[model samples]
Target chain A: MKRGFNFSPGPGTLPLEVLEQAAEEMLDWCGTGMGVMEMSHRGKAFMSILNQAQDDLRELLMVPDNYKILFMQGGAVAENAIIPMNLLGYCAETPPIADYIVTGFWSDKSQKEARRYCNVNIAASSEGRHFTHLPRQEEWKLSQDPAYIHICTNETIHGVEYFWEPDLPGVGLPEVPLVADVSSHILSRPMDVSKFGVMYGGAQKNIGPSGMTFVIVREDLLDRALPICPSVFTWKTVAENNSMYNTPPTYAIYIAGLVFEWLKRNGGLKAMEKQNVAKAQLLYGYLDSSNFYCTFVEKDCRSRMNVPFFLHDDALNDKFFAGAESYGLLQLNGHSSVGGVRASIYNAMPLAGVQALVDYLRDFERIHG
Target chain B: MKRGFNFSPGPGTLPLEVLEQAAEEMLDWCGTGMGVMEMSHRGKAFMSILNQAQDDLRELLMVPDNYKILFMQGGAVAENAIIPMNLLGYCAETPPIADYIVTGFWSDKSQKEARRYCNVNIAASSEGRHFTHLPRQEEWKLSQDPAYIHICTNETIHGVEYFWEPDLPGVGLPEVPLVADVSSHILSRPMDVSKFGVMYGGAQKNIGPSGMTFVIVREDLLDRALPICPSVFTWKTVAENNSMYNTPPTYAIYIAGLVFEWLKRNGGLKAMEKQNVAKAQLLYGYLDSSNFYCTFVEKDCRSRMNVPFFLHDDALNDKFFAGAESYGLLQLNGHSSVGGVRASIYNAMPLAGVQALVDYLRDFERIHG
Candidate 1:
C-alpha cells in the first residue's frame, strides 16, 4: 500500500489481504510444511487445494452443473483461437461461420483469431466510429445458423461496457449462443449465468493473476472441437479432468481460490456491484460535469470499471500524469492507442481509492480546468 | 521447511531463501510502491524486471549471441506440437522425416506429438530394458537426412539420464541439428549451449513453478518454422519481441528471475552441480548398499536428478509411504507406472534434505531390511 492505488488495466491490483495470506502461507500451507508452488499438482495436499479451489470457484460463480470451468494459460488471447477451434464443430465442414460484435480491441482480436478457425461474420462493429461506443444490439447483422456470437461485454482499452446482456430470444436469434469477454469488468457486478453460452477472461484483471484464465462454458458445447485444437486448450478435455488435464497453474489457482474466498467473506457479487456502481458514478460524474475533461464513450455504454478521459489541453497530459503519480493514483495514463487518463476500478480496487482519484480530479480541475 | 525433504519429481521443492524473498516482496517490490503482479507488463518498472530476468537467465546459461530465449507456456506438452511446427520448415512441402530417440515418458510424448507434424522415425529405444537405461548412441538407427534428432536429456519419470552430450560431428551421418527436452534438469547444471539447436521444458520441475517453459534455440532455427505455426508461438517472433509477443507469464518470470539470481549467488551452475551430484550419490549409495530396496536403472544411465527405486516387498509400499510421511518426508511415492518410489533431487531440494532422506532410508532398512 506504499504506492498509490494502481489502476493498470489487466495484470492489475489484487486485494492486499490475498497477497498477505499468500505470503504468510508461502513457507507452509495449512501446516503442510511446503509452499503451494513446491507441491506436485497431483499430491494429496495440492490436490485438496486444487479441489477446494475448483469447488469454491464453482460456488462463487454458481456455475451450472452442466457447464465446465476450465483453468488455462496463454491468457484470453489464446482463447481467441481456442474458443473457435473448440466450438466451431457445431457447423458443417467446408468452412464454418461465427458471428462477432466488435466493441473494441479485445473483440477485434477475438474476431481476427476466429478468422483463423472459420469464416467470421462481423455482425456488428463500432470500429468505424473509432470504438468510442458499443453499437446498439439492433444494428447487428448476425449470420444465419452461425457457430456462435461473440462480444466483449467490457472493452478494457476503449472504456465502453454493455450494461445489458443481449436478449437473443427477444431479438429473434433464439438458437444462437452468445459468448462474452468480461476480462476488465467480470465479478465487479452481477452476471446472468444462464444467458450466455460461454464467458472467458484472463485472470489478470478482475480475477487473480496472469498465467490462468477462467472459462465457463455450457455443458452442451463441450463435445465438439476442431481436430486442430491443441489437446490442452479443448474445453471438454479440460472440463472432464476438472482443469487438471495438463498440469494446471497450481499457484495461480490457489491464489484465485483465496480471492474467491475473500470475495465471499466481503459479501459476494451483489455487495461488490454496489461498491462498483458508487465508485464508477463518482468518477464519471466528475468527468461529465467538467468541461476540461472529455470522455469519448456514450453515457449508456460507459464502462463502470474503466473511465478513459482526456484533459482538454493535450500538452498538459504529462503534467497531469506526473501530478497524479505524486498523489499516488498510479497508472492514470491512458492506453497508448487512446492517450489521456484511465482509472480501472476492478473488484480489488477499494471505493476510497476511487474517491481519492475523484478528489484529485476535482482539485486539479480547480487549478487547471 | 517442515517436510523431511520433498523429492517428488516436479512442481518440486524450491529454495527456502527464494520463497522468503518472494513472500516479503509479494505486495510491494523494491519499495517501488507496487507488487510485481500488479504492474502492467509494458510499464518501465515491469519491463526492467522482465529484461533483467531474461538477461540474468541468458547470462546464467551463457546463451550464445545467435540463440534466442523464449519464455513460453503449456510447458513441453504444447511444445510437443510447437517444436515441430517451428522446425518442419527446414523440410520440403512434404515435410522431412524426423528422428526420435525414446528414453522415457516425456520423450515418448514428444514422439507422439511429432507424428502430427512430420514422418517420425524412432532412432533408438531403451524401453526394451524397461527404461532403466539409455540406449548407446551406436545402437540408434537414425534416418538419413532427418530434419533433427530429438531427445530428452533428463527423463523425469523413468529416472534414466543422458549424462553425456553426443558429439554429432563424429557420428558419420548427416549433421542434423539436435533438439532436447531438458525440462527436469535445467538450471541444475551447466549445459553446452552451442551443442543444441533447440531445447525446451516445463518450468514446474527445476525452473520455478508450473506453466513457464524456457526454450533456448540457436538463431538459425528461428526462421525454419512451418507456416501453420501460431503467430504467438513462433520462436522468431517471440525472440524479436523479447518474449512479449504475449504477456509472457509475468509472475512466473519474476520468481524464476529470483531463482536465477539465487543460483548465481550460490556459486553458479558448476557449484550447484557438485552439490547435486553429492546429494544424488548419497541417496543412491544408501539404496545400493541395502537389500531392502533396489533401483532399477543401469549404473551408466541412472539419473543424477531423479532416483526411482522399489522396496523388496510390494506389500510394504503402503507402510513405507506412511512411515515416510510420519517422518515428514513428502511426495516420495513412485510413479504409478513403475509402482515403486522416486526421489527427485531437483536443484531446489537442498543437499541436507537429501542427506536426511538417505538417513531415513538407512534407518528404514535397519528395521525393514
Candidate 2:
C-alpha cells in the first residue's frame, strides 16, 4: 500500500527513506546481531549510535562547541518545569522570576508550568491578537532581572513564527539568557545555536519520534539546577554524564540520528528550508488568492512548518477534511482548540505532498463553489 | 545472519515476532495510510493503538480494577524521583521518611535518590553479604511510620530476587504501602498485583523499549503527590489524562502493545513463569555442578530473569565472554559494577537460547579447565 502524506502536528511526518531504512534495520542494526531497541544503552554498539547521532546533529545545526546537546525525555511540556529547575539558580531573588514571551498555545503552557517552579512574568503576549502575529520585541515589559527569557519560536497550533531571533539590546532589555522552544520547526531551517542560551524541542516533529527531547544548552547554563530537580533531569548531571545519567530514549535517539543523517544527505537544513518555504508559499499563496479558504495567522508571521487555515463556509469543514483524506491526505484536521484545517508541512514533507494537497484543494473548490 | 542469544540486562532481547510485525507495519499501520510514529497521538488511529495496548497490558498483568496504569518517560532511573514525588505526601513527619529494603544495586540507587526528596531509612540491607542474598524479612528494622516501604523485587545487577512477597505480620512491620521496582523481571512470571501499592518498571526489559516507563499504582495512592511534583510526572495528572498529560512515547507504547499481544498469544504470565523457571533451572543447574563457574546469590533467592555467574578464574572472564560470543552468544559480559558474566534470560528469550549458552559453557569449561 502506498503511504499517504501525513500532516500530523507532531509524531508527525518522517522522510519515507528514513522509515524504510528503519524498517529494514528493525531486526538487526549495523550487523550488531541485536535490534537497536534491544541493545544496552551502555553497550558499545548503542554508545556509537548515540555519539554519532549527537555529532551529526551538532554538525548539521552548526551547534557551537561550547554548547552541549542532550537527548532527554518528557518533551517540551515537561521541560517547562525542568527549565526553571535548572535555570532559576542564577536569580538571586527569593523566588526567581522567569520572563516569558507568550506567542501562542505552547508558550502559554510553558508559562503556566513554570509558575509551579518559579515566579513567572509575561514579558510579552500575542494572545491579545489571538496569537496571529508576534508581539514586537520593543513592547515587551522587560523585568529588572530574570533568571531567563523564554519564547516558543514557532507556535504549532497558532501557525505563528518568529522570522528572526529577538534582539534584547534593541528591545531595551539587558543582555540575558534566551531559551527557545523550537519543537515544531527545529531542523526545518538553519539555526544560529550560539545566539540562544538554550534551545530545546520534542523529537516528534522535525526530528524523529515522540519519546526523546533534544536540549541544546550552552555549557555555562548547565550548572545551576535547583536542589529539587530530579537527578536524571538535571541539566548538569545529564550533560556531565553525556545524557547517560540515565538510560535515554535509545530507540527514539536512534531514529533521530537517522533523520539527522537524512537531513545531511539531502543538502542539510539549507535545502530543507528552501523546500519548506516553497511548500508554505504554495499553501498560503493558494489560501490568499482563494476567497473560499482563509488563514487566521498574519502573512508575515505565518509558520513555514504548520499552516492552519479554514474554509469560508463552516459547513464545508467536514466535507473539506473528508475530501482531503480521500485524496490520501491524512491528519489535515486542525487542532480542537483551533477548529479548521492544519497542514503541517515539516522538513520531511516533500513539495510533491504539498502540491498533492494543493491540487486537492483546487479540485474540492471547483466541485463545491 | 542468525540472531544470537542476547544477554544484555536491560534494553535486552525482544520476541523476534514482535520486531517482524513492527517492521511490516513501519510504513503504514492497518491501512491507516500513515505509520504509527507518523500519526498524531490524538488521532483516531493512534488512540485505538494506545487503548488496545493499555487493554492488552491490563489483561496480561491481571491488574486490579482499582489500579491506574501510567505510561511515562525517563526509564526507571527517572521514576526513582518521580515515585517519591508522587507517593511521599502520606508522611506527616517534619521530613517524610521512606523505608528502603536495599537488597542490591537498584534498591540502593532508589533509596539514594529518594534521599533528595525525603529522609530515607534503610530498613534492611544485603550489603553486609556483598549483595549476595536477600536479607530475611525478620531481620529488617521497620520504620514505625514511614511514608512507604520500597523494595526491588528483582535486583538486575546482583542477581538477587525475592521469591515471596513480604507479609508485614510475618516480619513485625506495619501495614504501610509497598512500592516495588520490578524493572528487569516484570512479566517474566506471574505476579499478584493486589499485593503491592505500586509496581513500576522501565519497558526496556520485559516490555518494549528504553523510552517508556510503566507505573501500575493503586488509585488511592495517586493523590498524595507533593506540590513540587512536575505535573507531567505526577500520577494523578497522568492518570486523569490517561498518560496523555504530555505526548507519551507513542512508538514505545505501540511496541509494548505488540509485546503484550505476543505474551498473550504465547500463553499468559502463568505459562511464561513455567518457561522462565525452566530456563533459569537449566543455567543454574549447570553452574551448580561445574567447578569452573559459580553463581554468588543464595540458592533460595535467585532471579529467574537475570542470572549473574562468574568464572572461578577471574582471568578467564575475557576468554569466557569471547568464547560465548563466538558461539552465537552476545553480551555475555556482566555489568561493570559486577566483574563477571551475566546471562539475562528474559521472557522473550527462548529455552533454546539458554540451552545454547549452557552448551557453550560446558564446551568452554572442557577446553579451559
Candidate 3:
C-alpha cells in the first residue's frame, strides 16, 4: 500500500521504510521477546537502543565532543520557558537580559516566555514586515553582557528561514552565546554545532515523533540553571544521567533511533540538504511562475522545509484544498494564524511527492486561474 | 510466537492485543492515508483519535465531570516540581505549606521537589519501617492549612500501596486538596476521582507507553500556577488547551487510547480489578505458603501491581533469576535500590503469566530448598 504525500507542518511525514521497520519490530525488538515499549529503560536491551541512538545522532550531525545530546519532553513550546530557566542564572546581571532575533511566531514566543525569568531584549525583528524575512545580525541592537542571543532558525508558520549562520564577532558583539530553536529544520541541512552554545529542536518535524525534544548543548552551558528550574528540565542533570534523568521516553527514543539510522543509510545531512533544496526550489518555482498563487516570505529568506503560499482568489482556496486532497496531497492547509496553504517537505518527503504536488498545483491553476 | 512472562516494574508489560493493533495501524489508521504518528495533532484524523481516547479513558475511570483529563509530557518525576509550581500559588500563606505522606521513593521525591517552591511537612512516613507499609491516616500529623496534601497511592519501587482513600475530614483537617501519584496502579481498580484534587501518572505502567503523563485535575484547581511555572507545565493552560498546549506525545496518547478501548471491550475497571485481585492473591498465596520465598512488604499494604519477594537464601538469588529467564520469565529482578525479585503484573499481564511464575517459583524452591 502506498502512503500519501503528507505535507503537514509538523508531526510531519516520516520515511515509509522506517515506519515499516518499526511495525515489523513492534511485537519483539531484536528477538528480545518483548516489545521495545515494554522494556525497562535501564535494561540492557533498551540501554543499547538508547546508546546506539545517541551515538548515531551525534555522528549524523557531527555534534562536537564538548556537547551533550539530551532526549527531552514537552516540545519546543516548553523549551521556550525551559531555555530561560536553565540559562538565566549564567549571566552576571542582576536580572539578566537575553537578546532575541524575532523572525516569526516561535521566536516571538521565546522572547515572551523569557520575560518571566529575565529582561528580554528584542535585538532585531521582522515583525513590522509581518515576519516576511529573517533579521540580519548586523541590524541587531544587542544588550551588553546578555545571557544569550536566541533565534528560531526556521519559522514553520510564516515560512521564513535563516540561510546564514550568525557571526557574533562580525556584528561587533562580544562573544555572547548563541542559542537556537531549530525545531523545524534541525536535520534538513548540516549545522555548525560549535557556532552556538545550545541547539535544540522538537523531533516531530524532520526527526521522528512528536513527544520527544532533542537538546544539543555545549558542556560549558551546563549547571547554570536557576534554583527554581525543575530537576527534570535542568540540562546538566539530564546530560549527567545520559538523558535518563527520569525514564527518558524510551519508545520515542527508539523511533528516533530508527530515524537517525535511516538518515545515515541515505547519506546523512549533506544529501538530505540537497533534496530539501531541490524540493523547495521546485515548489517555489511553480508558485513564482503562476500568477494564480503567491508566497509572502522574502525570496532570500524562504524556508526550504515549509512553503506557505496563498491563492490569488480567496474563493478558490477551498477548491484547491479539495483537489489537492483528491490527488493524495494531504494537510496542505496553512497554520490557522496565517491562512492559505503550506507544503512542508521534510527529510522523509520524496522528490516524487513534490513533483506530484506541482502537478496538482498546475492542474488546479488551469481550472481556476 | 508466545511472548515471555514479563514482570518489569514500570514500562513493564502491555496487552498483546494492543501491540498487534498498533502494528496493524502503523501504516494507516482507520483508512486515513497517514499513520497516527505522521498525522498533525490538529488534523481531523488525529483529533478523532485524541478525542476518542480521552472519552474512552474518562468512561473507563468514571472520572468526575468537574475533572479535566490532560495528556501531558515530562513523566511523573517532572510532575513533582510541576505540581508545586501549579498549586503553591493557590495557598493563602506567605510561603504555603504542603503536607506529604511519604510511603516510598516517589512521594519522598515529590516532597523534596516541592520544598523548592513551598514549605513541606512530612505529615506521615513509612521510611522508618523501610517503606514496608502504608502510613495510616490516623497517625498522620496534619498541618495547619497547607497548599495541598500529596501521596503516592502506589509505589513501584518498594511495592507498597494504599488500599484505602484518605479521609481528610476524619483526621480533623480542613478541605485541603489531596494529590496522589497513582502511576503504577491507576487503572488496576475503581477510583473515586472526587476524593482527590488531582491524580496524575506516567503512562509506562498500567496505561501505555512512556513520555506521556496523564493528569486528572479538578477544574477548580486549574489556574493557580506560580508565575515561575513554565507555561507548558501550567495545568490550567494545558487543561484550557485540551492537552494541545503543546503538540502532546501524539503516538503515546494514541496507544493509550487503544489501551482504553481494549479495557472497555473487556469489562472496564471493575472487571480489571477482579482479575488483578486474583493474580495478586495467586502469587502472594504461593509465597505465603512457602518458607522458601518471603515478601517484605506488609501483607495488607502489598501492591497488586508490583510484588517484590526475596529467596530464603541470598545465595540462590542469581540462580533463581537465571532459572526464571530460562523458563520464559523476563525482567523479574527488582529495582536496583531494592535487591530481590519483583513481579509487576499490571493490567496487561494475564493470569496464566502469574501462574507460570508460581510454577517457576515452586520449581526453584524444590531445587534449592
Candidate 4:
C-alpha cells in the first residue's frame, strides 16, 4: 500500500519498510508461533528481542560500557518527576538544587514538574526571546553546586535546537552532570554519549512508538534514587533487571528494536543525519525564499527535525492546512500554543516527502500572494 | 496460518481475530491515511480511538456514571506505587494508614509497594496457609477509619481467586473504600465497578498488550492526591486530561479497544464467565479424578483463570511439560516461585483451547500411568 507523508510531530511517520515488516510479523514473529505481543517478557524469545534491541541501540549510539540503557514507560513527561526522584539522592546537601536551561515548551514543562520534588533553579531561559533561540552558554548562570544540569536539546514546539553540547568547564562547573531530553531529535543525528551524564526521550519521535521511554544513564548515576521513587521508574532498579523490572512494554520494545535494525541497515546515524539535514534544508530554504511564509526560529539554532512556520496572511491559515492536506501532506497544523504550521521531518521522513511538502508550500504562496 | 495455543501468564495470547484486524489496518485506520500508532494523541483520529476504547470498557463492565475511566501507561507493577500516591491523600489522619488483605503473591507485592507512601496494616492474611485460600472475612482484623483497603481479587501465581467481593459491612469496615488489582481476571466476568473505589490492571492479560494500564476510579476519589504525586500518575490529573495527560499507549489501547469490541460481540461478560467456569471445571474435575495430577489451591478458591497443578511423580515434571508441548500446549510451565505447571486461561482463550489441553492431559496420563 502506498503511504503519504506524515508530520504529526510525535507518533510520527515510520519508515515504510519498518511498518511493512511489523505488519508481516504481526501474527507470527520469526516462526515463534506467537505475536511479539503475546510472548512472556521473561521467556527466551522476548529476552532475545529485548537484548538485541538494547545491544543494537548501544552499538548505534556508541554508548560507553559504563552507561546502562533502560527501556521504561511513562514517556518524557513522567520522567520530569522521575528524574528528580532519582537524582536528588546524589546531592551532598539538603534541598538539592538542580539547574535547568529552559529553551521552549518541553524544557519549561520539565522545570515545572521538577519543582514537586526538589529545589529547581532555572539558570537560563530563552522564554524572554519568545523561545526563538537557545540561551547562549556564556550567559547561563551556573549554580555553585548542583546535582545535575538539565536541557532539552531539541524543542519540538518552538523549533529551536542546541547544535553544541553544553561544556560545564566553560561555565566553571565542571563536576556537574548534564541531563538532556533529546526526544525529538535523538536518532535523527549522531550523538556523543560520554559528554552527557544522562540522555532520555520518548520513543514516538525518532524512535518507534508512543508508550516506551529510553533512559541512557552513566553507571555512577544509577545508585541515587530517593526512597519515594517507584521501583519501576528507578533507573538503578530498571538497570539491575536489565529493563525487565516490569514488563518493559514488550511489543513497543520489539518495534523499537526493529527500528534500530532498520537504522543500522540504512547506514546508521551518520546516514540518517545526512538525509535529515537535506529534508530540513529543502523545506526551510523554500520558506526563507518566500515573503508569504516565514520561520520564526533563529538561523543558528533552528531544529532540523521540526520546522514551525507561519503564513504572512493569518487569514490564509485554514486554507493553507486544507490545501496541504488535499495534496497528501498531513498533520502540518502547528501546536495550539504555537499558531503556525509545523513540518516535523524526522529520520523516517524521506527527502521526497519534504520535496512534496516544499512543492505544496510554493504552490500555496503563489496562489495566495 | 495455523497458530498454536499460547498459555503465557501475560504479555500473553490475544485473539487471532484481533491480530488479523490490526495487520489489516496497519497502514490506514478507518479510512484515515495514518496508522493508529502514527496519529497525534490530541488529534481527532487517535482521540476517537481512545474514546471508543474507554466507552466500550465502561459498557462491558457496566461501570457507574460516577466512575472515571483513565488510560495510563506503566502497567500494573507501576500502578502498585501510583495507587498509594494517589489514594493516601484521602486519609484524615497523619501518615495515612491503609489496610491490605494479603491473599497471595500479587497482594504481597501490593502491600510492600504501598509502604512507600503510607502506613500499611495487614487486615487479613492467607500467607500462613501458603496462599492456597482466601482469608475468611470473619477473621479479618479491620482497621478503624483507614484510608482504604487493598486486595488482589485473583492471585496469578497461587492460582486462587475470590468468587465474591469482600463486603465491607461484613468485615466491619463499612465506610472504607476497597482498591483491587484485578490484573489477570478483569474482563473474564462481569464486575460491579461501583462496589470498589478503584479498579486497575495492566492490559497484557485479557485486555490486549503491555505498556497500557486502565484505571476505573470513583469521581469522589479524584481530589485527594498528595503534593508529591507525579502529575501523570495522579488520578485527578489523568481524569481531567481524559487520560491524555501523556501520549498514552496509543497502539496498545487501540488493540484493547478491539478486544473489548470482540468481547461485546461474543456475548459480553456473561458469556465469558460461563465459558470460563466450564473450562476450569473440566480441568479441575479431571485433576480430581486422576492420581497422576493434583491442584494445590482450595477447591472453593481455585481460580477459573489460572490453574496450577503438580504431577504426582515429581520426577515426571519435565517429561509432562515436554509431552504437553508436543500436543501444541505451550507456556504450561509454572512460575519459578511456584514450581509446578500452570495454565492461565484468560478471556482470550476459547473453550476449544482448554478442551485440547484437557485431552492432552488425559492422553499423557494414559501413556505414562
Candidate 5:
C-alpha cells in the first residue's frame, strides 16, 4: 500500500528523513518528556526549536541582517490581502499605488487581493500570450512611486517560472521594493534575500507542511503595517515578539527545522538546485521528445519544480491518470482549468520519483498513443 | 526521559494514542508510498483520509447536516478577526451589532479582534472580578438584535467555565445566533451542538495540533461572507469545498481523525467527561483541603478542565514548580498575567497524569508548606 508520488503543488511531500525524525521525537522531544507539539511556545524546548529553525533558514537563504523572517499562517492566499494591507500602510495620504507583474494564477490572485487594499497598477502581464510565457523586464509598464512592485517568481499552476532574478537597480522600479509571491520555489535553490524587500510562501510546497508560511522581509518594512492589520499578522508585532506574538504552528516549524537540517546534510541549496535541474531535465526531455505529449510553457520559462503537461490526445486523460496511478506515479491530473497532467517535483521529491514518473510517462505514451 | 505535564493553555497535550498512530504512519500511510505528511491534500489517499476524518467527527459530534464543519489554519487568533469579517456580511445593512461576553484572556482577544469589523457590545464581563467566575447572565446588557452573541464557553487562562449552557431565551438574544469560541474545551466533554450557531476551536488544545482549527457553523450563516474575505477563511467557501479548497493540513486532520476514533473507542465524549471530572476533582480536592494552596475561581464556575491554583506563600512558587518538574509534572508555570500555577487536563491527559500531579503536590507541600 505504498503511496504514489504526490504531485500536489503544496501541502505536498516532505522528506522521509524529516518525518522519521519527527515521529521518533513525537512523544518526547529532546528529553523533555513532552513532544514539540505539546510544549508551550514560550518554553525553553520550543524556543530552542523555533530559534534554531529561524537561524538555520536564515543561514541557508543567506538572509542579510536587515531582514526579519516571520513564521505566519494562512498561506500565500491570505498574504495576498495581508501584503497589501501591510505594505500599503504608508499610503496615509490616500490609498497607495502598488504595481503588479502578472505571470499566472498566483499573480492574478495577488493583483486582485491587492486591489482591495490599494490602487493597483498592472505594470506588466503575459496575459496577452495566454500566460504560457514570461514577459521580459523590458516590457513592463513602469509606475511612479508605487508602494511595491509585486511578482510571482514561480507560478505553480501555469508552470512558467522566472529562472533569472529581476534587476530593479537601474530600472524605474528600483525605489519601489519588489515583493514576490515565491510560494512554489522559495527553498528549491538559494535566494538573494536582499534582492527583494519581502518574500513570502506557504510552507506546504517546498518548506515542510501546510499550517505554516515563511516570510522574509527587510527589517525596516516591519513598522509599516496598516492600522487595519490584525496584530497577530502584523510583522512589527511578530518580529518584536520573536515570531511568538501568537502561538505559531509549533510542530510545523519543528518539521521545517528538520527539513532545513536535512537540506544542509544533503548539501546546500546549490547542490539542491543541481539536483532539481537534473530532475526537471529528465522529465521535460522525455515529454518534449514524445509527440504524444505537449508542455504548454515555453522552453526557457518552464518551471524547474512544477511541470504541467497535456497529452496530444485529450480523450485518454482519465485512462492516462488511472494508468499512472497503478504504476505508483500519482496526482498527474492537471488543474481543472487546464485539464491534462501536472507533476509537481517539490524539494521533498527525490530524483527517483521523477525517473519513475518519466518512465511511466514514456510507457503510458507508448501504449496510449 | 519522560516529559513533564505540559500545562500551557494551548499547543497543548494530545492523546497518547493519536501521537502513537501518527508516529507509526510517518514513513508510509497504510502502504501508500508516502507519509500523510508527504501526501497532497488533493491526492486520493489524503482525500480519503480527510473524508473519513470529517465523517467520523460529524458522527462523534452529531453535527447537523445544515451545519458546515471547516478545517482551517491560523488558530483561534486569526479566526477572531476572520469571524467578524465573514459574519458581518449578514449584519452589513444593520449597524453591525455583535455581543461578546469576555471572561478571560482568550475572550478578551476575541472581543478585541471582533471590534475591528463590527459594533461589538460587551454583553457581559468577568474581567473586573479578576476572571474568577463566568459573568452572571442576568447582569448581561443584551442588545435587541445582534448579528451574533459571542461567548468564550471555556476560558483557557483563568480556568473559569460556564457549568451550564447560556440561556438567552428570556433576552432578545435568543433569535440572535450564539457564537462560541470553544478553543480550550471543545471536545473534553459532550457539547449540545444545537445550542451554538457556531463553535470553533484551535486544534492545539483538545483536538489535534496547533496549526489546524475546527469550525462548526450552521448552514444559513454560511453565505454571508464579506466580498473581501479571503476564500480560505470564508465559512461558505470552506464548507462547499469540504475543507480542501486550499491544501489542508492533511497530517493534522489525519491526526485529529485518529484522536476522534480513539475517543470513540474509549466511550466517546460522555466517557471523556467522566474521566475529566474525576481527574479535576482529584487535583482540586487536594488544593481545597491544603492550607498552603488555593484556587481563585468560585466553586460553581470552576473549570473541570483547566485548574489554576497558587501557593498561599508566593515565595515557594518556584520551589513548588521545580519540585513538580522533578516528578515529571511539567508546564506548571501559570500565565505571566496571573502570577500563579495552572494545570490543564485535556481529553488526551489521562487521570494518571492528574494523579501524578496530585501525588507530587502533596509531597511538595509536605516539605515546603
Candidate 6:
C-alpha cells in the first residue's frame, strides 16, 4: 500500500524503512526470544539497546563529552515545568529569576510554567506581531543574573524558527545559561553543542515517536534540580543512572534508535539538513509564486519544517482539504489557532513527497485560481 | 521462531495476538495511509483509537461514571510525585497531612515523595516483616483527618499484594480517599473501582508497554492540584482535554487499545482471573512441593502477577537460571535488590507458559537437586 504524505505538526511522518524494520522486529527482536517491549530494562539485551541509542544519538549530534543526554518521558510539555524545577534552585537566588524570549506558543508556555517556581521575565516577545518574526538579540532585555534564558528555536504552531542560536554574551548576559525547546526542528540541521546549557525536544518530529523527550544538558547544570523535582526527572539522578532512572520508554527509545541509525546511514545531520533545506525551498518557492495562497509568517524567520499558508478565498477551505486528502496529502489543516493550511515537511519527509504536494497545489490552483 | 515465557516484572510479557495485530498495522492503519505512530493526536483516526481504548477499559473495569480516566505520560515512578502534587492541595489544609500504608518498595517511595509537598504519616508498615505479609486493617493507625491514604496494592519488586480493599470506615476514617498503585496487578482480575479515589499503573506489566501511565481519578478529586503542579500532569486539565492536553504517548495508547480489545474477546476479567489463578497455583504449588525451591512472600499475600523465589543452595542460582534459559524461559533473574528468582505471570502469560515453567522446575530439580 502506498503511504500518504503525513504533514502532521508532530507525531509526524517517520521513514518507511524504519517502520518496516520495526514491524519485522515487532514479534522477536534479533533472536532475543522476546520483543523489545517485552524485554526487561535491566536485562543485557535491552541494556545494549539503551546504551547503543544514547551513543548513536551522541555521535550523530556530535554531543560534547561535557553534556549529558537524558532519555525522558512526558514530551516537551512536561519539560516546561521540569526545566524551571531543575534550574531555578540551581541559581539559588533569594527569588531566582528566569528570562524567556517568547517567540511563539511553546516558549510562551515555558515562561508561564516557570512562573510557578520562580520569577519570570519576558526578555522579548514576537507575540506583538502575531509570532510572525523572532525577537532579535538586540531587542532582548536580559535580566541581571537570571538563572537561564529560554527560547523555542522552532515554534510548531506559529511556524517560526530561529536561524541562529541565542547569543547570551551579545545580550550582556555572558554567565547565564541558554536553554532551548527545539521540538519541531532538532535534527533538521546541525546545532553547536556548546552554545546552550540545555537542548531539549519531543522526539515525534524529525526523529521518531511520541512519549520520549531527548534532553542534552551540560554536566555542570545537572545538579540544579529543586527539591520538588520528581526523582526520575532530576537531571543528576537521571544522568548518573544513564537515563535508566525509570524504564526509559523502552520501545520509543528502540524506534528512536532505529531513526538515529537511519540518520547515520543517510549521511548524518549535514546531509539531512541539506535535504531538508531543499524540501523547504520547493514548498516555499511554490507558495511564494502562487496567487491563490499566502503565508503569514515573515520569510526570514519562517519554519522550514512547518509551512502555514492560507487560501485566498476562505470559503474553499473544506474543498481544499478534501482534495488534498484524495491526493494522499494528510494533516494539512493549520492549527486551530491559526486558521489555514500547514505543511509540516520534517526530516522524514522526502523531496518526492514535497514535489507531489507542489503538484497538487498547482492542480488545485489551476481549477480555482 | 518461538517466543519465550517472559517474567521480568514490569515490561513483562505481552499477549501474542496484540503484537501480531500491531505488526500488521505498522505501516498503514486500517487504510488511513499512515501508521498509528504517524497519525496526529488530534486527527480522527487516532482520536477514535484513544476514545475506543478508554471506553473499552472503562467497560472492562466497570469504572463508575463519576471517575475520570486520564491517559498520562511518565511511568509509576513519576507518579510517586505527581499524585501528591495533585491531591494535597485539594484538602486545603495548612501543611496538609497524608497517610501512607507502606507495604513494600513502591509504597515506601510514594510516601517519601509525598514528603516534598505535604506531611506524610506511615499509618502501617510491613517492612519490619520483610514485606512477607500485609498488615491487617486493625493494625493501621489512623491520622487525624489526613488528606488521603496511599498504598501500593501490588509491590512489583517484592511480590506482595493486597487481596482486600482498605476498610477505611472500619478504621474510623471513612472520609479519607484511598489511592493505590496497581501497576503490576492491574487488569489481572476484577477490581472494585468504587473503593478507591484513584487507581494508577504503568502499562508495561499487564496492560501494554512503558511510556504510558493509566490514571483513574474520581471526578470530585480532580481540581486539587498544588500551586506548583505541572499543568500537563494536572488531573482536571488532562481529563477535560480527553487526554490530549499534550501529544499523549500515541503509539503506546494504540497498542494498549489492541490489548483491551483482546481482553474483551477473551471473555473479560472473570475468565482472565480464572486463568490467572490457575497459572499462579501451578507455579506456587510446584514450589511448595519442592525441597529445592521456596518463595519469600507469604501464601495469603502472594501476587498472582509476580512470584519471587530462592534456590535452597544459593550457589546453584547461576545453574538454575542458565538451565531455565536453555528451556526457552527468560528474565528469570530477580531484581538486584533481592538476589533470587522472580516469575511475573501477568494476564498475558497463558496457563501453558506456567505449565512449561513447572515442567522445567521439576526437570531441574531431578538433574541438579
Q: Candidates' DockQ values?
A: 0.65, 0.85, 0.80, 0.77, 0.64, 0.83
Residue A15 Cα positional deviation in candidate 1, in Å, after optimal superposition: 0.7
Per-residue lDDT tens digits for candidate 6, residues A1-369, read: 779998999899999999999999998999888999999889899999989999998998899999999999999999999999998776746699999999888899889889999999999998888899988898888887799999999999889989988666766666778999988999888988789999999999988899999999999887788998889888899999998878878999999999999999999999999998999999999999988999888889989999989999999999999999999999999999878999999989999999999999999999998
Q: In CAPRI terms, where does candidate 3 land?
A: high
Cα lDDT, model 1, residue B351: 81
Task: Please write out the lDDT profile of model 1 over residues A290-360, one tens digit for every residue.
Answer: 89899889888999998888999999888888888888888777888888888888999998899899888
| Model 1 C-alpha lDDT versus the unseen true structure | 0.85
DockQ of 6: 0.83
Poorest lDDT segment (10 consecutive residues) of candidate 5 chain A: A86-95
Q: Give the poorly placed runs of model 3, Cα more than 4 Å off.
A: A172-175
Stretches of model 1 off by over 4 angstroms after superposition: A170-175, B1-3, B93-96, B172-175
Error of 6 at A93 (Å): 4.2
- Put down candidate 3 lDDT per residue, A276-368, tens digits, no spaces: 999999999999999999988989999999999999898888888888888889999989998999999999999999999999999888977
Q: Put down candidate 1 lDDT per residue, B301-366, tens digits, no spaces.
A: 888899899989988889888888888889998877787889999988888888878888888878
Q: Candidate 5: which stretches are off by over 4 Å? A: A1-5, B1-5, B92-95
Which structure among the candidates has the greatest DockQ?
Answer: 2
Cα displacement (angstroms), candidate 3, residue B259, comes to: 0.4
**How far out, in Å, is residue B223 in model 1?**
1.9
Identify the CAPRI category of the predicted complex in candidate 6. Answer: high
Point out the worst 10-residue segment of candidate 3 chain A by lDDT. Answer: A168-177
Model 1, position B304, has a per-residue lDDT of: 86
Worst 10 residues of 6 chain A by lDDT: A166-175
Give each prediction's root-mean-square deviation over alpha carbons: 1.7, 1.3, 1.1, 1.1, 1.9, 1.1
* Best of the two (1, 6) by DockQ: 6
